[model samples]
Target: MKAVEYRLPKEFDKSFIVFTERGTYFPCPWHYHPEYEFVLVNRSTGRRMVGDHIGYFDEGDLVFMGPALPHVWVNDAAYVQGQAKEEASAVVVHFVEDFLGKNFLSLPELEPLKKVLDLSKRGLVITGKTKKEINRRINGMIGESGLRRLSSLFTIFDILTHSSEYQPLASPSYMQHTQGYYSDRFSKITDYILRNFQHEISLNEVASEANMATTTFCNFFKEHYRMTFVEYLNTIRIGHVCKLLADSDENVVNIAYECGFNNLANFNRQFKRLKGMSPSEYRKTLELQSA
Candidate 1:
């Protein structure tokens, strides 16, 4: 279950890359790379996992991710099972942080852009007018060539830098803890946890996977993830529970056990703790959104 390191397609002659993906569903697993990424989910709805943040993402979803942040958009079960009539599609832009130049972002004129890039370390979801404009620019970029494409990219960045309609997805603590430890072992551990979180998991077993003693593993996980193993596990589980609550008609009790909570009370407590609402309330919120 180790996360595969994704090597994005790079053209030696180009400074950045833009592409569109259309599929039955997003096929990549939990993975990360060194390039910054801006993604527009043109069509589809699903669970999106970025760093330690988990939530629902839908059509018109716009997210900007900094270098080395692990993420994936897992289309809902209906999309995967071909129950949905439309295919999933997205436009993704990838570039290095210094794609302009090593010192360009350090210039006084570009200071605001630098701040936007820094905030993107936690992942940024653009909304309101900015998202609509950026989406238009992204579509335009798909048809541009040479300097026009780069111009559109910079324009999008300028809008994002000036707009106040962006939300940071992950906690600052989560970003701080995970920034410097981009090793194979860390990737493997995350991959294992993401794949197995729906079932019972034990620290001892995970520690064995990392070849560390239980105590050492616990400390290591806390140091890097800024949360105890169990807390992180529950965060992931509750995230899935939120998705099911929003997207399906399954009973809350069944969803609770299906998401790995052993009992109703614990599920309700953890759901409230993480989301600040009961599962039923959260579902009602979704209904309101749909209405």
Candidate 2:
């Protein structure tokens, strides 16, 4: 109950059109709401963890997650290493299930879209044509009124229902655990890791930062992230390393050291384990890649 951060639209009592200019830290600490969420990560690169899904996300990444589904966007970057952080802004809309109507979902007129929303109960990645329409409609919603706003949202689902371009990201029946004292503790812990992934961050230091016993911290951290504190630390670090691997001309050994990996051999091994490739191999693949 304490997990979901429900910051509804400014005039949510009358309408569900939610819009905000996200700061460098967009949605942090894997929070969800009781409302359906539509987010377009305009042009940006950041860490994305929703439900049990964990990966790096880039510009034009559009995602939808149902109520109380934990998700996060960890981007403290001014730039992707030497390159600039993405220039585009993030657009978001949040609405309750009942905002439209109960039968709106039950109607055969809405079945395909109904199934998509059902899939979105886990999470959804809307791409291709649907992404274009959602982006266009979200932009069009900036100055709309009561009925117009609802109709715009209806149009969004219209695209989702008809488009096979949409993909489900989180597994069916997925549930995210983000409750209690551990939530507060890891909010602090993960926030710190994002802020300091460029350097060495030890479990002891992180536990001290959270003011928790190491063993207790490890257990709690694992429960939330499904990995020990060190593992989560490496996750954040490895992401930065990938940013470097793809965006930088830096040497693999140097990038490893820069990302806080103490030993080169270990860096290569861990990068492979987490990224499915050696550092050099990852870098080579990114050579002149568009995204």
Candidate 3:
């Protein structure tokens, strides 16, 4: 699918830009650009799309996305419908790879930092102690100025470089192919899917959305997303299930149906296939972590 290219605000004269976002919802479409982005979701609950990966994210979601890695954070329907608080917030940092100077990362002493940057090409989700530390540093940068702000940014990078509490978001083979004619077409298809996935989605309807035949649409989707359309739909549904499992005491069968699954057996199978655990097991893990 095609993604929109987003241009970051260019008012900052420094090597990087840092800002805080507070809104009723995360306001961005599926998009990509040439900046390396480090974002911490201080508040919000939703699904995050990174490259071809679809998953759930909540408060304390810290992600480092390398240049041109397409991503977006879509708030749940509650936030969009104003049922939840209107003040969804985040701390975001955007910069180029050579923001420190072209030769900076090339230095032998900066090899570890370089490795972090390279690995971030697939997108990185910082977690555990590393995420907590980076969250503090990011919040600190919101008030600092001049060199102090820059120092806090570097401290985040150093911690990320040294810590193993992170996971890659996208596959190595995933690429942003949304250039020229296919851009809007892809965005329309993905948007429709994300909006209507809770109901019965017919391949015929989605193929028509792309102005392609069913066979052609299937081939095109698999080529670009590396999965069949049904697989991608299930990924999104399972992501929603995860958010409910962590945030609510909803019944598993109820959540499955609410997430658009038709039956418990199928939902359990797909959940286990994608997440490597049964729904109860996954919920237990979350409980253990919180305890």
Give TM per candidate.
Answer: 0.64, 0.55, 0.62
Clash-forming residue pairs, model 1:
none
Residue 172 of model 2 has an lDDT of 26
Ranking by TM-score: 1, 3, 2
**Candidate 2 lDDT over residue span 1-291, tens digit each:** 123465654573565756744554554444667888887777677666665455577777788887777676655356434355444367788877776667666777866665666667657777787788898888778677788877888888877767778665543213322211134665677667767766777778888899988888788778867777667667666766765654467787888888788887777777788766677765554442222
Per-residue lDDT of candidate 1, residues 175-287 (tens digit):
54333334678767776777788799999888988889999999999998779999988877886776677558999999999889998898899988887678888777555
Candidate 3 residue pairs in clash (backbone atoms < 3 Å): 2-186
Model 1 lDDT, full chain set: 0.81
Candidate models: Cα lDDT each: 0.81, 0.67, 0.80
Cand. 1 TM to true fold: 0.64
Best by lDDT: 1
Model 1: runs farther than 4 Å from truth?
177-271, 275-291
Clashes of 3: 1
In candidate 3, residue 64 scores what lDDT? 92
lDDT of 1 at 145: 81
Name the candidate, 1 or 3, with the larger TM-score value.
Answer: 1
Model 2, stretches more than 4 Å misplaced? Answer: 1-4, 9-13, 79-88, 176-291
lDDT of 3 by residue, 15-97 (tens): 78888988888787768899999889988898787765667889889999888887878787788777886578999899987
